[model samples]
Target: MTVQPTEPTTPRLEWFKSSYSTGNGGECVEVAAAPTHVHIRDSKWPSGPMLTLGPGAWASFVGLIAD
Candidate 1:
């Protein structure tokens, strides 16, 4: 699987937070989408480590969480 690299050499993305996110900032994540991959990072640390997933994997993850 290929991932959209967002290293220091790559441009940053406009990430969207989940609707479930609250001002309490307890546990929240942000996501950004590209043509072939989806990028996910911690909302509390936008510049921190990230997890990249392929389109199909992303779909399955979302489906599992939605169930």
Candidate 2:
């Protein structure tokens, strides 16, 4: 039997783009907040793929990058 993945039942996410985004055309990153996870996407393609990571994982990623 073919298995179909269940869709996200979570409510709509509130996406926010970085303030550093250039007013002109350029690449940027967008992020969204979920109850237990964070969603990341490319600002260049709002409808593009998203990378979802746990809150802890996101925090660690940020800490590492900030170091």
Cα lDDT tens digits for candidate 1, 1-67: 9988665965558899988887786757899998778999999898799999999999999999999
Model 1: residues >4 Å from true position, as ranges? 1-11
**lDDT for each candidate structure:** 0.88, 0.88
Q: Which regions of candidate 2 fall more than 4 Å away from where they truly are?
A: 1-9
Minimum summed lDDT over a 10-residue window in model 1 is located at 5-14
In model 2, state the lDDT of residue 67: 100
Using TM-score as the measure, the top candidate is: 1
| Reference-based TM-score of each model | 0.78, 0.75
Give lDDT tens digits, candidate 2, residues 6-59.
Answer: 978868888888777875877478899888899999988888899999999999
What's the lDDT for candidate 1?
0.88
